[model samples]
Target: MASIARPALLRQVCNAAPTRRMASTFAGSSLKHPSPLTRRPMQSAFATPGASRVAAFHASGRRPILPPLPQVVDGDVNKPAPIPEPSASHGSYHWTFERLISAGLIPLTIAPFAAGSLNPLMDASLCALIIVHSHIGFQSNIIDYFPEKRIPLIRKGSFWLLRIGTVLLGISMYSFETNDVGITEAIKRIWHA
Candidate 1:
């Protein structure tokens, strides 16, 4: 009895409605009847009329799992790559500055200990160089981890935070040198203690 009723129910559902509808109801009478392939799906009766499409990942208002890639203009593959404009600051100059700081550190680091006393000027220079080296290293890490193109907000925030931290450290180091025993002296005391 149940097997005979199931086929009757299936037939009713299959023949219930037309697959295609007149477009005059939704679209402004320009299209009389749209083909089944081009017709839009009917909205759920419970869904709001003005509801906007939302991303599945960002539905809960959290950051995206993966950052979006930067847009690149596609060009002819046969064409040769364009030459980049010359800029010393972005190229050799920045690298040269970092190398100089690194090289200066070895001598400045040795001079105070060799002399058995810290000259205030030499100590200050050493401190400044160390700070600059650390800042450069941290800036590189931030750039690598949080790229400006993909995650601009995070990258800018990290940069500003780094700047603030560098400034605070410089101020504190200056105060430590002037107000009390200098960096070398403090390190020596700590080493002996």
Candidate 2:
């Protein structure tokens, strides 16, 4: 099939009128001739002459007048805002700990193969770190997509699900390491196979 030029294609679309099908869709609808209420300009309660409507609303006792907003005092313009106290469990410390785990994994991953033997402790540590890293990544995703403010129930459910899954994964990993070949040995066997 021959392709039309961009300009010609645009001109063809712009010049085309609405089809019979499109016009017929709205033929029986009130949309063809809108009501006078739709034609009139919108009036606000605060605007002049519209204030009587506000009075009428109050007279009818439908809704009470809202209280004024609380006044906020401005501090010095040049001075910086007060810094929040840091906690070890969250904020920068949590981020630094995650980074440390990620950096530690690189050496732990290479050391087993390079040394030509799988240390059980190193294998266990690597597996634990990977699980923690995955949990953190999934937690970040849950926080981004299902925020507490937007979908509180879903966010709580996802967090609980993540916790449960991580626990199950850890239990399974422990079982795998104890009952059969550990992660490193399994990988080596698979690689040789």
Candidate 3:
């Protein structure tokens, strides 16, 4: 009886003042006069009769429950395992992307130079650049969106990037092809000016 009363008293004291007074009171009471709540129950009729066992619960006061572990909550486990950081293979993958883009840009860059020389054949080079860039851009998307074997909604955006890049690149290329000779000579003359 005295043991159980101590917890209740400490609880009250703690509730009243959550300071050194409550901490000291709890420490003093728990060590010197252990509460009944802390004591193990003796074997009794409550132990054998399953229905009567519930009666014991009603008699004893409810104990304050401790907070749950930080990771789990509301029946759903919340912590997702961290994704592994990129590896050496990541460097290789980046290299692959660089190579692809570099290849596409090469023809595109040269087509402009040829156009500035007023070569009508430069239009074909421009077309080649735009087409190859579109094709390579689509391939890059394959690396991104097809890794898991299925097309994710994310891949949908790739189509747009490829289309826009192709159209804009082609238009830029075609314009330079037509105006190359006069534009180049004018820029040269301006530099002399």
TM-score of each: 0.56, 0.58, 0.29
lDDT of 2 at 82: 67
**Candidate 1 — which residues are off by over 4 angstroms?**
1-86
- What's the candidate order when arranged by decreasing lDDT? 1, 2, 3
Instruction: Please say which candidate is ahead in lDDT: 1 or 2.
Output: 1
The C-alpha stretches of model 2 lying farther than 4 A from their native spots are 1-31, 34-87
Q: Write the per-residue lDDT of candidate 3 for residues 1-193, one digit (tens) a residue.
A: 5536656545534332333233353556445434333433442333333322343457674454842233424334775766879797667796786576667667656654665533445445545644665666676776665543244444666666667877786676567656664333445457779
Q: Better model by TM-score, 1 or 2?
A: 2
Two-way TM-score contest, 1 vs 3, winner: 1
lDDT of 1 at 158: 95
Score candidate 1 by TM-score against the native. Answer: 0.56
Model 2 accuracy (lDDT, Cα): 0.68
Expressed as tens digits, the lDDT of each residue in 142-193 for candidate 1 is 9898976567899999999999999999999999989978888888888899
Q: How accurate is candidate 3 locally (lDDT)?
A: 0.53
Deviation (Å) of 165 in candidate 2: 0.7
The candidate that wins on TM-score is 2
Candidate lDDT values, in order: 0.70, 0.68, 0.53
